[model samples]
Target: MTKADLIESVYLKTGFSKKESAEIVELVFDLIKTTLEKGEKIKIAGFGNFVVKEKDSRRGRNPQTGDEIEISSRRILTFKPSQVLKGAINDSNA
Candidate 1:
C-alpha cells in the first residue's frame, strides 16, 4: 500500500492523531534509510531483512540503440523476507 494508506491504517489502529502517525511512519522510514546508508542491515522479526548490496561494474547493451555501454557499479538496497513472513503469505494464499 501507499504511504498515505499505511499512515491511515496506523492511525485507525492506534487511535493516534494523523500528524503523529505520519511522523512515526516517516521516522521509521528515515531510520531505515539512515541505517542502510551506513552499509548496515535491518531485521524485523517475522517480517524481513533490509540490506545494502554491492554491484560490480558491467557492460550492457542499450535496448533502443543496441549499442554497448558501460554500467557503473553501485550499492543497491534489497529486502529478503523472513521465513515466518513467507509462511504467513503462503498460508494466506492457500
Candidate 2:
C-alpha cells in the first residue's frame, strides 16, 4: 500500500493522530534506510531480512546495438523472506 494508506491504517489501529502516525512511519522508514546505508541488515522475526548486497563489475551486451559493454559494480538492497512468511505465502497459494 501507499504511505498515506499505511499512515491511515496506523492511525485507525493505534488511535494516533494522522500527524503522529505519519511521523512514526517516516521515522521507521528513515531508520531502515540509514541502517541499510551503513551496510547492516534489518530483520523482523516473522517478516523478512533486509540486506545490502554487492554486485561485481561485469561485461554485458547492449540489447539495442548488440555491442559489448562494461557494467559497473553496485550495491543493491535485497529482502529474504523469513520461514514463517514463506510458509504463510505457500499456505495461502495452496
Best by lDDT: 2
lDDT of all predictions, in order shown?
0.97, 0.98
Model 1 stretches astray by more than 4 angstroms? none
After aligning candidate 2 to the native by TM-score, how far in Å is the CA of 89 from where it should be? 2.1
- Please give, for residues 1-94, the per-residue lDDT of candidate 2 as tens digits: 9999999999999999999999999999999999999999999999999999999999999999999999999999999999999999999998
Report residue 3 deviation for candidate 2 (angstroms): 0.9
Per-residue accuracy of model 1 over 5-91 as CA lDDT, tens digit each: 999999999999999999999999999889999999999999999999999999999999999999999999999999999999999
Worst 10 residues of 2 by lDDT: 28-37
Residue pairs in candidate 2 whose N, alpha carbon or C atoms collide under 3 angstroms = none
Q: Give the TM-score of candidate 1.
A: 0.92
Candidate 1 clashing pairs, residues 3+ apart or interchain: none
Work out the TM-score per prediction: 0.92, 0.94
Span of 10 residues, lowest total lDDT, candidate 1: 28-37
